[model samples]
Structure formats: C-alpha cells, structure tokens
Target: MDARAEHDSDTRAVSRAVSELARRTRFPIAFGGLAQGGAIHVSSIVGARTRSLDGLVVQETRGLGGRAFAEKRPRLALDYRTSRSITHDYDGQVLSEGIATLFAVPVLVSGRSRGVLYCGSWGQAGVGDVVARPAFAVAEELATELRVGEEVRRRLATMPPPATSDAMAPAMQEELRESFAELRSIASTVTDTAVRERLTKLEQRLAALSRPAGPAAEFDVRLSPRELDVLACAALGATNAEIAAELNLREGTVKSYLQSAMGKLEASTRHAAVAKARRAGILP
Candidate 1:
C-alpha cells in the first residue's frame, strides 16, 4: 500500500483502540492520536460533549500526554486543573471538556512510542489499578497492531512483484512463508476480536500471493486456526520443538496440531502436509 493508505489504516486501528478504552474503563471521555513529526495529533475521540478536543496536537514535554509520550510511561492527573507536575498547554481544550481527571498512556511498540492514549472523567477520580489496567491493555493492543503493520510493510517493500509464470523464485517463496508464519504467531497472542480479524485478513493476503496460477482448485478441507498456525511454522522448516517454543505450546501439543493438520490435508508427512497446504492456497 501507499504511504497515505498506510497512515489511514494506522489511524483506524488507533480509533478502534480509543473506543475500546472508553468501553473497558467506563471512562466518560477518551481521545488519542498517533505520532507524526514528533507530535501526537489527536485524531480519535469518544464520549466527548464538545469539540474542544478536535485538532488537538500534543508536543513532547508540553503537557500530560506529551510527558507520557516522551517518558514512554503512563501519567495521571487526579485533578487536572490543579496539577503541577504537567504543563497546561492544552488546558483550554481539556478543561473546556470538563475533564477533572485525566490519564495518559503512551502506545509503545518495540520500545518506541508510536502514539498516546488518553482517558478522562468529568470528576476528580484517582486512577487505581482497576482504571489503569484496561488503559494499559488498550495501549498495548494498539502497539501490537502498529508493530504488525510495520513488519508487513517492511516485508512488502522487499518482496518482488507477482510472477507471470507458474513457478515463483525459491527465495521469494521462502520470504512469503516466513512472513505467513510470523503473522500467524503474532495473531495467536492477540486478544482483541477486531485486531485478530485484521490480522487474519493480512494472513489471507499473504496466502493469496503465493497462490498457484490459473483457476483455483476445489478443496473440501478446512484447517483450524491452530492447525494452520502449526502448518505455517512447519513450512518454514521449524521442528515441532521449535514451533512449541515459538508458540508457547508443549512439544506434544505441537505434534498433535501438526498431525491434525496433516490428517486434514490428507498428507503422510509434515513436509507433504505443508506442500499440499501451499497448493491449496492455505499457506503463502
């Protein structure tokens, strides 16, 4: 995808995360945005009574959100109007929304801050473990989405265009298989339903890339998610033990998944199962 399309996709992920933050924490107000040009430009908001938060841009070291972004940690203002620890650069917009207390969490991906998320209330409320946990979870979820997108884009950049002939280059096929396995590994750990769905779509795209030319084949087999995950890892020449370690599954469990997938694909061996899956357009 182009840069503009990528940006829009990231923004949509952030917007969904902000909405989830509000729903999970029961916060009356939630708004957040991704970093661009060293600033967090607020792009998503929920449960706000006014347009004060619209077009809000937070720079590093400038306000509560900025401090959280710069420090790569969560910051809380039990009393927003009287907080001395943070600068009041955005108070005009913040206070206008009657947000008496605010909590800011930086969306950190691979140890770098990609964005900041904020949840607020109309009354003074201390952010204990109960309120803080869901906000952190939401930020982590968004961070995972950003991380996956970055990896996908990086892989796409290095990949060659689709082949005209029936056979793809061996190196290109290996890269696609690796990408498919990595995406499946990441998808296994994601808890959010929407994010998992997005990852699944990306997985499908990767699978379609290596699809055989000409009319599609008719296959009656359907592999479970775990079965597909095991098969994808196996396609990368990963041993059952190695797949277990990567997927946090027991060695026997990994074997079981692989055997199940092979049975479904009507293959006699793991290698055969992977080959059949690729031919069926089930793995990239």
Candidate 2:
C-alpha cells in the first residue's frame, strides 16, 4: 500500500499496544509522535480517559518526553512534579491527566528520534526499575516495527512489478512471505503481551510481501550496557568461560550477569537464558 496507509496501520497497531499495555501493566500509557515544531504530543492513551491534550507539547529539552527524545533513551521520574533533572513545562497536562509516576522512552530510527512512549502511575510515585524495564521493552519493540516497516516500504518502492506482469515477481513474493513469516515467529516468541500485539501487525504486513524473513530477531531487553554485551556473547554460543575470556570478566561475574538476566526472564539455565532473552527482545 501507500506510505499514508502504512502509517495509519502502524498507528492502529500502536493504539492496540497502548490498550494491551494498559490492561497488562499497572501504569497509564501514552504514545506521542514528535510534531514539526519539535513538540511531543500524545497520540494515544490507555488506562486513562482519552481527551485532547494537544496544547501540551513537550518541547525539545523540556519535560519527560522531550528529555527522552533529546537523550535518545528512556527516562524515569519517581514524581513528575518534583523531578529536578528535567523540565516540567508540561505540568498543566500532567495535572490534567492526574499523572504521578512517569516513565518515557524515545522511539528512534537510524539514530533519529521519531516518537516517544510513556507510562504513568497516577497518584503514586516511585515506579522504580521494575516498571522502567517494561516501559523500555514496549518502546524498543515499537521502534523495531517502525524501522522494519520503513525498510520494507523503501524496498517495495525500488522494485515494483512490470505493468504487464503480476504485482510482484515470484522471488520478490517469496521474499516478502518469508520475511513476514519470520516476523510472525519473532512476534510469537516475544513473551510480553504488548510487544506481541504490536509486532503481530508488522509481521502481517511483511508476510504479505513475502514469506517474512529478514535480519535475525534483534530485541532490546533494556539490560545494562554490560549485561547486553554479555548476552550478545552468550547468544553466539560462548560458554561463561569463553565469555570471561572475551570480556576480561571473571567467570563468576559473567555467570552473575547471566543469572540476573535469566531471573528477569524467569528462565532456568544458560540455554533458557538465551531463549528467554531472545523472546523478550533482549538479545538477537
């Protein structure tokens, strides 16, 4: 389909994600697209009334979303009104929405900010790292979909079928199908409910293009930088001993990081750690 159509579909997919996140999470959810004037405005809401908060645009370098977009990573606030690290220019909107605990993650594509995803806990603060992980988890999944969809659209534009032939060649058709299939597999493998729903839609689109195969599943599990590095090594079939050799970390430290990841994923072994990490979009 066209770009607008693709964008609309993605928007709906995000809406569904917000809904699912609201249902599964204790936080209120909001997704926002960065407008032309460098303002972040809420695009969808869940666990709260959907009203027009258009007047509340998170300006660049200001507010939670702006800081997220500026920093190009996730930001958390135990209390929005009292958070001193970031600007509170959107205090009116926060008050209107009755938001307290706030977490924001920037949605990036090729190192550029495209949007922001946020979760809020009303009346209470101190969401801690527990909520932070899941919030980043959702944002990362959404970013992947946006990136993949953009890539798919670009590929389609460059290789349209001849006027006298089918809409797509057999090989192209197969590629699309395979890509979609793999996308579906990745989506299915994700344990987080919100992530699964958003990815399912992206997978459907890719499948219609071909069998749905592309890059191996690369998920961002919001592990600390060191944890991510260790997981990457583990995914390559490195033993803790080998991982220690590569990273110059003690085997006990390597094992500890692995154990922490496994615990977060509720997994039982190193193999299960990799599997669960893959499923959670923490590792490729």
TM-score for all models, in order of appearance: 0.95, 0.59
TM-score of 2: 0.59
Residues 103-152 of candidate 1 have per-residue lDDT tens digits of 99999999999899999999998888888999999999999999999998
Q: Which stretches of candidate 1 lie over 4 Å from their true place?
A: 162-167
Per-residue lDDT tens digits for candidate 2, residues 1-284, read 68579868677656655665555456655555543467765667766654535545677778888988988888888777888988877787776777778877787867888777777777676766666666666666666666666765665665546334435565565444334433433343356665556565554444333222344344445565456556656766678898787777899998898878777666687778767665444443
- Return the clash pairs for model 1, or none: none
Error of 1 at 214 (Å): 3.0
Indicate the residue-level lDDT of 153 in model 2.
69
Error in Å for residue 249 of model 2: 24
**At residue 148, what lDDT does model 1 achieve?**
92
Top lDDT hit: 1
